[model samples]
Target: MIFSHEFSETSEYSAGTYTTPTDYFRYTLKVFEPGRSVAEPIMTIEEDYAFLMDSQWIAQLPEVREESVSAAPNELIVYFCDMFPFQRSVRDDSTRLLRDEIHNYIHNDLGPGMLEAFRIQSSDWGFIWYGDWTSSRPGADSERLSVALTKNGTWYHGRAPARGHSWISISVEGGVNAYYENLTDGLISAFYHELFHNLQRNMSLELGGNANIDGKEDAWQFFTEGMAVFASSIGMTHVQFSQTTKARAYLAEANKFVAGGGLLDGELNNSYKAMF
Candidate 1:
């Protein structure tokens, strides 16, 4: 629905790595077999068949369905909780997309500048991790995964949330890049955070970000968490923007932005007026 035309799905991982949908479909069809039949199923049967499918397989929903379940085999609904974009531990050394997939998103030509530069060198794997420290929650450890399906959009489907503890519902995430960038309490993981509430745990949880994060607990938390433009921006940091000095610098300039304000406005004109 987000695109004018539907893009094909990315494939599931196979053997040592992931494969695309076209690859898997080609593999499963065996069209080259000598005695294979290739007739398409009748439309009515096809539609009925698709309707009864588990959430994950309901690719495109047809606009119309026949009055009833004419060919359904059973009444049970398939659950796919383990399938959501789930959370997990991501170490620096692991074979994961976070570290490897960054090649897909090229930053500004001059580079992600000092406002919060991501400086991993090309020779150094070009990957950084959205790490986890929940090892003590063995149930929530990385050794296993849980999946489920729920009625969302048009179908019940598999979803994985970014990483966290086991008994806790996963914070849903997907895509090679999105998968690894999630998991932190930081801003870029906002998608992962939402997945945690809606699809994984299905419970509303309290969350803070650029607008609501507190400076007292983490001086950079407010700015890093507060001023970020995108979810991923929350993770950006300036090498020079130390929590200690930066806060004082901000307060020093806030007298003007704060003249009519209680907080550091930092708006260019307002900050200039307050500081000068």
Candidate 2:
């Protein structure tokens, strides 16, 4: 069962003026097993907005807008920009596919282990803020981006829940394609990588009050990003990486590394060299 609530409000941000007030819908999902008295409920909050540009480059462009949709009990909200090439429905389907893979991994493999290690609630609700638009900084191309905002810790732009909550954001502007023939393998990997950032933040909060690593920020980034890449690799395999052209390209690189005896050498490798 699903219960949804819509809310509309006007708010000002440093970026620009909201031509059309920001609005969002909160969906509460309840799942009950047959012949069981207990139910599992998850909440998904979605926010959509349109802004009048203040930047000179896109100032002439019409108001940019975006929306979000939930895949019912999936515990995630997939945000998509209207200006993007892919239609809303297409983006939704791809997001649902990714969400299903993530859900399975989290519940079946990572959930219990994480709960025990972090001592935090094992809820799976999260957000996937996507698109090409610049919602964080003005005049910058924020195409391929991923970030995690810890509640009450720091505000990195965009809407987030109140204190004590955390969320993830992903931008697919650089790699997203309108053609169904071009699969979203890169976007899928990026989504999983960003999702891992959310998981890292949650674990950090359980160990430390804030998500920041204090003096070890750089080292923390190194570890987190490497792990995120590793997680994405695993996720791609689960989603049948061979089916996507982009994934095949990634696998080719991996195979090259293995062929060079890198796998047995215990070498520290990362998805990106700069990550170290």
Candidate 3:
């Protein structure tokens, strides 16, 4: 079963334990207004995310969930704002119609730009959910977050200041269940982007440098994006993924130039360049 917990402007932590890992998974709602709660959804997006914490998905995504504070701490805050489709007609003032309008605008207008916006918001979820208490920022990043308690561990997520650089993740703003469809292959991009950013925290890399392949931190971003875009059904066959070796893949190039490396990091790296 699913247990839902809601947090408010004055609310902080709950008072007890939850259910099992599979039993208790948490998700954050993107409220456009100032004061909103899950009970009062307002918006219908859950940020682009999902996790099993089963340990077997490691190779494909290779990462484990670590436990944080015992109670809710705005841990994994997810911030989302519905967009109005640029050239579509709202027809009326219904939420369903509004959501459709927003989706259309994303596809035709924002185009690739939406990728940057979504990534910025998504990484916040990763940081808040996994980062320690002392790692939180107050008024600076004023987005609200929520968490659900489970028997195994609490499901944490939320949003932070939306003004940061889009270094950690690839954000796709307009659609729900994006993974199941094909559009420049955005779904696959989101999937790999999620783990690459989340797992990068554990690896040593130059992530937020200038170029996409800077070093430690930046490497995974390159590795994943390159592979994802290349593998994307969008059919970016123009750039080769296998023959690309070049070794210039994000994680690989970064560690060699600076200092970094870890499990799955390398495969994610050189393997992509191997395509060129």
Say which candidate scores most in lDDT: 2
lDDT of 3 by residue, 1-276 (tens): 555655333433375454433323446555555675656656755543344342100001112233444311232322223331211112322213243344444345333333332333334334333332121224523221211111111122233212111222223332321222222233233333333332333222223333333356444554544433332322222222334423212323345323325333444334545623
Worst 10 residues of 3 by lDDT: 54-63
Each model's TM-score, in the order given? 0.19, 0.35, 0.26
Clashes of 1: 34
> Candidate 1 lDDT, tens digit per residue, 1-276?
231433244433454444332211222222234454555422222111111322211111112221234211111111222222223222332422242232222122111221122221111213212112111123422221222322122223223333222222323233222323222222123322222221111111112222223234443332332222222222333311334422322233345343434343434444433443
Off by over 4 Å in 3: 1-64, 67-75, 86-97, 100-188, 205-213, 216-276
lDDT of 1 at 63: 20
The digit string of per-residue lDDT tens for model 2 on 189-256 reads 54555545555554455554465532253645444555555665665564535565444323533543
Candidate 2 Cα RMSD (Å): 21.8
True-vs-predicted CA distance for residue 95, candidate 2, Å: 16
**Number of backbone collisions per candidate:** 34, 0, 44
Identify the runs in model 2 with alpha carbons over 4 angstroms from their true place: 1-75, 87-167, 176-183, 213-217, 238-276
Sorted by TM-score, highest first, which candidate order results? 2, 3, 1
